[model samples]
Target: MRTFDVPSAPAFWQDPHSFFSSSETAQGGVFASGDGAVSVLGFDALDQLGRNPALDGHPFPAGGMGSPGLDALLRWGLFALTAPEHQPLRRAVAAGFGARRIETLLPLLRRAAVEHCREAARRGQADLVHDVAAPLAGLAFCALVDLEPLQAGALVAAVEEIGRQLSPDSAPDGTEAAGQQAEAVLEMLRALEAAGASPLMRDIAERLPPDTPARPADLVAALVLDSIETMTAGLACALDCLLRQSGVAEAVAADRYGWPLAVQEAFRLTSPVLLTARMAQADIAWQDDIIRRGTTVMLWWPSGNVDPRRFERPFTFEPLRPQARHLAFGTGSHSCLGRQLAAMLAEELAAALLPKEGQRAIRIGETVFLQRFARLPREAPIRFA
Candidate 1:
């Protein structure tokens, strides 16, 4: 295995914009050094690397805590469900997210968005991250997985715990708690499978061929874990953007597509998954740097997204800026599976909050790098008039 040096202070994991700004050379080049490889990509190079298969698949390092033995479970689940052996099962699951299915669910999503706003209005002052964003994300996940609406909150909490456990500094007690939660979640999945109820469970059961070797519990666990972590982080980032932007909340309420674009822009700026790595299949030269066949390649999504050479006024939050290609959801086979769902949630949440005017402006009180939120105060005191 090729050895790579850990980044001393990775801006992608902390403040992505500052990282790019600091790394910019007088010649308009951005130098990236990590994992014993030094490569420079012009701001515009993101298109070539992010979209093109030849350059986009480089593996990058993962920041933060390692999941305790759960990574294996995730890999196994993905292989069993999406690999060639499970094509039929994959196709079946995809049907639930088909155009018709998503269309059918749009009304429910709108209602949920309205209800979330009503509840927040009742509280007057609410923690936007926990009370609003979290529940909104949870509901989106529930829709994707076909879980009961009432169970979304608990399921989201369990998934958040799993993500927290991935942090390297998690104490023994925290780890123990996470394990317990995981077990409980697994048990719930088992119970759901046994009951043969719930559209999601029934669809999964019916679609997965009898001869397939994938277990229901493993599949459910993977879905729940992946759904929760990505959705929560994405929603938090989206909310952060609305709080920073002027009139975005109102625009979202007035226009259906307005907030979704803003959310996408935020995703580009604050890539939730900072670094991803892939082992080189063969020796390749990247802009004069030779990457040997066995080397592990790391792709920096945040850096690539904001390269001044690529994005005009890269630091500014201009949602209306013409469509710019970004690596927020990644590319090729490894691209995120739930990009559409994330966009939908961001749009709905922004729209819902727009009507409650005179609410306190949202503020992020304390932020810990790589951690979702320590405290996000949304002291929006409001009443539904």
Candidate 2:
């Protein structure tokens, strides 16, 4: 197998798009690390791997992410579940994000978007991400679990604290302070459930079987953990794409109906949530080698999204391209459960903010990335007219 040392690859950390678009990954589409982990880069290969039952979706190793709270997040989170345990929990959470439910939240999302845009317009300047996208995501999250939108700031802070531990650059030895933060979040969730204040907890309880291993609060925590960052990142990236391209923002703003296609293309180009992993449950056959059980297979989403074999002019942004679908949200059983919510948030925010004619946002700073799966920029500054 071709070797690609992912940990030492500075480009992969500093600038993932260029790293994945390189000729090495475009040619072979597969690589093996010194630690025996395999990376799959082809769209078709990733699709096949996602569907393969021999691979387990549970992400954490046996020793866990270092603390009981962190370990619980890894073990009980929806994306990390496997087989018998996964289906029921998925169904429960999926109920909250159903079409009827999302439709009910549309007005709320639209109102929040308009309010944020109004504030930006009054100031004549704003951070496109922080002032707009992040707040919209926070409002959507509060709506989902039945919290007041006013509580969004505090809720977002708690989730971010928990999420920091999952970053690649997080300290190897979990800090005592970090552990306390995780514990506090978990304890608050449990307390909310006990007091009957969490509608998400009730939704899960209604759908989940009586003997289920996971607590209702755990499922709610997982949903909160997964929802805000990805939705916020996706909206910011799509908005960034529109602002950078010359006529695209004006065209999308005029059409209204075109935002979905625009967001889809942006997702293809930027490919948020760079990678996902699965553990081989049994021996598997590859092109010229065997993948033994217990091996970790990393699915590189950016590589698959830009595969030359699958996309014509793969590097270019074309919303109306013939093959518009991509693996930004992944595929198969463990695919993102909140994909619909993410798309809705992006479209609504774009529709609300983009006005008819000459008023629009102009980018003032370059986008950046942190050592995390989410490709969201720390600051994407813009001025509104």
* C-alpha TM-scores of all predictions: 0.76, 0.92
Q: Give the TM-score of candidate 1.
A: 0.76
lDDT, residue 351, candidate 1: 66
Report the lDDT tens digits of candidate 2 across residue range 55-96: 777556655667776666556776677777777778987875
lDDT of 1 by residue, 1-385 (tens): 2222334453434564454443442242324355455333334433344343333233212321233434433543332232344446555555544556556667787898778777777766566667776787777766755667798888878876776775544455576667667777777777767776556656666677778766555566666765566666666666666666776666665763476677778777766555545444456554544556654445556666777666778777777777566776555444556667767776777667664465433554543455332212223222333
